[model samples]
Target: MTRRQAITATATLGLALLLLAMGAAARPLLVDEHPLSRPVLNPTEIGFAQDMLAHHSQALIMTARLDQTADPTVVALADRIEATQREEIGELKGWLRMAGASTVNNAPMQWMHPNNSVTDHHHHAATPSETADGGPAMPGMATQTELDALSAARGTDAARSFLHMMTRHHYGGIQMAQAANNLLTDGIVKQTARDMMTNQTQEAALMEIMLNSLTTAR
Candidate 1:
């Protein structure tokens, strides 16, 4: 209320605003701005980014299917899944763009183990017919056959199959997310990946909730 007190209050407010602006400017950017922290991705970063995009796409597609097919539980779960994955898709693309790569150079299978010759049990999702002459499978993609089967189901059959496929789909998502969290050394990106796995692992439980609903509905 006094003049001196008012002056001091204004000074404090101005100082706070100036500090806030400086803090924001200090934050890292994907391009131009120096990265807040150096990248820890190495080879697996590509695999992580590439496959996770594909995985997110499939999740979007499956969620879209559930939306169109008109299942309340599936639709609810799908909305939740879609919201998370799409945001992550933006982050992944940002990484790719910042890294100056048009595509992930390694095969999707390589995401499993870059150093060792581990055989992939998840290979059937990408057949020769689906790819361009023996290249690494598109990161996180599902096969056309699987897509067709999902499209063909109706009512409870459709709902049940969606639950099963989505369960498997979630496992794949968690793998890619967890791999980044466990392996990546970059602080911010690793933290982001860790946050993603934290959310996805929780979201994965929604599939189980959907399953129980479907079972009760039947």
Candidate 2:
């Protein structure tokens, strides 16, 4: 081949190699390092965090009243509930914040039944619980009257009331956690929800056993 032909062919090959290298380097920047990239979470995850926070808050309130009971078993159970739930609440809040989600939501449980904008009468599905003044209600929450009653009870009565209320509360919590397990894409959030469901289910069973004991004694 002529020197000129050899030089031109070498130049063409070098330019092609450089172009390929540039594209290779730019590929990741275009796909992974885009400035608009943000963590994606669905509505179900957001609702779970928001609803569970409210649910755990009520659990804390109930557990705080454990001092009114003379039962050591009851008090110990309450202490465990308070401590575990507080930590879980923190985790939920952290996950929500990291995902750029707000714990504050205008409509509660919408993700549980996304299709049903109105309140429906299904066991698994939930509609938003609204008050006369339009305040949202947490599922399985005790009324103020019930709270006052629980506060006034002593001995076995307090123990029994707490067990009854808490068991119901945990059922609601398990439902929410199960929904989260099904919905959330994030591994941390999904695993957290699974742990919650398992823990709360066992706790609820224990509470029922204790409640039955109290009943049998009377």
Candidate 3:
């Protein structure tokens, strides 16, 4: 309308734009730009991944040692177990790598008991074969002697030994997975743990039934 009025309106718009720009500048930047914002695994997640990797590795070893002449059902179960564990191992390793964590853990099973609190019945004093981090041997892990026995056995004996050992192994894995699932609030790792618990629990039950049938057939 008037020149003075137009000038006043223009100044007010400029001031509003300046305030908006300042507000945007004051906001926090994206976390991707910060070093601390990089993906970090909590102690529980790191421990689960590392220990489970070791556990799954042993399962592979057991499957590799299985006698080819064993029962077809037993052989098939071993193959399935190997395949599942191998895929999970890859995922665990990927997560660990993304977090810049070591794939191998010297101190195992610490995640189950934070702050020296141990209430699990499965916890046992460390044996000479598996003493790590001043803690007990991981539950359900076969001793070297047992593994050697399984390696030496053949045919039905091999299947029986494998079924027994793997059943126990699955039990241990279920325990660890359950613990991880409980400890983690919510994340990919937690979901992975829950899946492991379900899968391993079912496997263990099947193994038990197989073992019973094998024994009865003998």
Candidate 4:
């Protein structure tokens, strides 16, 4: 080829390469890589975190009364539950915050079962178990009267009451956790829910055994 032709070819190739480089540099970055990325959390994930936070809070409250009981085994079990649940509460709250959700939602269980009418401080046509004050009644949760009864009892009575309430509470928690596992795809959220179900199911069985022993003694 001639010298001029060679120079022209080299210049043309350089121009093309520069254009390609500019195009590559000008391309937009993926929006998902932003600090608040999508896909947004679904209702179920948000609902589970909100509900479980309250649920775990109640468990902690029940366990707090265990120190009043005489049975060392019961006290030990309560301690374990309180510690495990407390840590899990932090995790749940953190997950909610990271997802840009509020920890203090008024309609607690509405996410689990959606209803358009349910609003803060009111749940029109709510399920029978739900209270106007506290939202829906999760499975196996103790009523105020029951909590009072547990708090008032002492020695073996306190021990038995604690066992009974905890057994029920764990079962309820497992149901919610299982639902979270089913609905959520987030790795940490799903794993945490699965762990709760496994651990609480075992705890519920142990509580039943303790309750039985107490009953037989009575």
Candidate 5:
């Protein structure tokens, strides 16, 4: 089997017991050459940076619920997620503040393939999605159905829903982050994107593990 297959199998079989003992403490290795580094921030970067902060802020609000009522295991995970995302929100805001940009731009953009990357070269800070084919797509965010379900859950139920929806949430998030990585030149934004990729990827893996535990227990 391929290395990925091997890792998947290992993750499926043994990762659970290890997680309870090890918890979610994996820190990403910072590679020297940033794949997302750029020099000049673009509209795409501004939109991505601000939108992601808003998105993650919602996650923080959701995860805080877990901290209040979930099992200890889930509460542990929620705490980690909340801490990391809070720090990221601060970092993204700092970038906007430094750029003298308002995070409140109403420009609607979607996350698109690299072919349609939007750079904030104009420094409009208006957001890329506001422009359409003029920029990337940033829609498909979680809806009220998902949020209500999250609010209604308790114990492992809450844990499972949080992880499942959050996996999808982080999937979109990674797309936005990748766009920012490609579209911006600001060192801090680039660093923040890299950190998001590293940390969220690891958290997603752990969430999947916890999710499987929920299934098996059922």
Candidate 6:
């Protein structure tokens, strides 16, 4: 080929390459403006995080209401639950914040039963009367009346109440965690849910043994 023709071909190729580079650089900007940009967390993950955070918050409240004079073993269990759940709450909050989601879930338990048409009328902070009237927004949660009884008990009675209430609470939490683990493909939240299930299952078993012993002694 002639030198002039070869130079013309090279210049044409260079121009095409530059245009491609510019288009590549501008592509992301266009994508950022699109209405269907990818989300950091899917609906299931966000719902799980929000619901679990509320569940963990309730556990903390239960722990706080435990009578100080309860059995040493019972007190220790309450302390451990308080500490572990508090840390988990922090992790859940961080995930929600990163995803730009509200900390509270207006429609609790929707993630577990997506087809059930669970509406936003269910609040995480249900009134005590509402819970006592057999309307726990989530499974395994204690009614406000049950909590009040726990708060009012003392010594062995307090221990008994706490063991019973927390055991049920843990079972509910386990149910949610198990659902989350199964629903999530892979992520920090999935792993956390698995860990929660394992730990809470063990704790529930321990509580049952404790309850049986207390019953036998009584």
For model 4, residues 1-218, the per-residue Cα lDDT tens digits are 99999999999999999999987776645343347556445667778888899889888988876645369999988989999999999988888888889886676666655644455424323322354344345666667767778878899989988998888788888878887887776777788889999999999999999999989999
lDDT string, candidate 5, 140-206, tens digits: 2455556677888877788888888777667667766776777666666677787888888888788
> What does the lDDT read for residue 137 in candidate 4?
55
Q: Rank the candidates by lDDT, best first.
A: 6, 3, 2, 4, 1, 5
Show pairs that collide, candidate 6. Answer: none
Please say which candidate is ahead in lDDT: 3 or 5: 3
Best candidate according to lDDT: 6
- For residues 24-61, what per-residue lDDT tens digits would candidate 6 score against the true structure? 99998877755776678899999999999988888998
Candidate 6: residue 101 lDDT (0-100):
99
Candidate 2 Cα errors over 4 Å, as ranges: 1-40, 118-135
Error of 6 at 151 (Å): 0.8
| TM-score list, all predictions | 0.67, 0.77, 0.79, 0.77, 0.65, 0.81
* Candidate 5: clashing residue pairs, number: 16
**Candidate 1 residue-wise lDDT at 192:** 75
Tens digit of lDDT per residue, candidate 1, span 1-218? Answer: 99999999999999999998887877654245653674534566766777777777777887666535657667667677788788988888888787765554445647556664544535444432245333235333455666667788776777777777777677666766777877876765677778877786776687788788888878
lDDT of 5: 0.68
Worst 10 residues of 2 by lDDT: 124-133
Ranking by TM-score: 6, 3, 2, 4, 1, 5
lDDT of each: 0.68, 0.79, 0.85, 0.78, 0.68, 0.87
Per-model C-alpha RMSD: 13.4, 3.9, 4.6, 4.2, 24.6, 4.6
- Collision count of model 2: 0
Q: Which stretches of candidate 4 lie over 4 Å from their true place?
A: 1-25, 29-36, 39-41, 114-136
Best-fitting candidate, scored by TM-score: 6
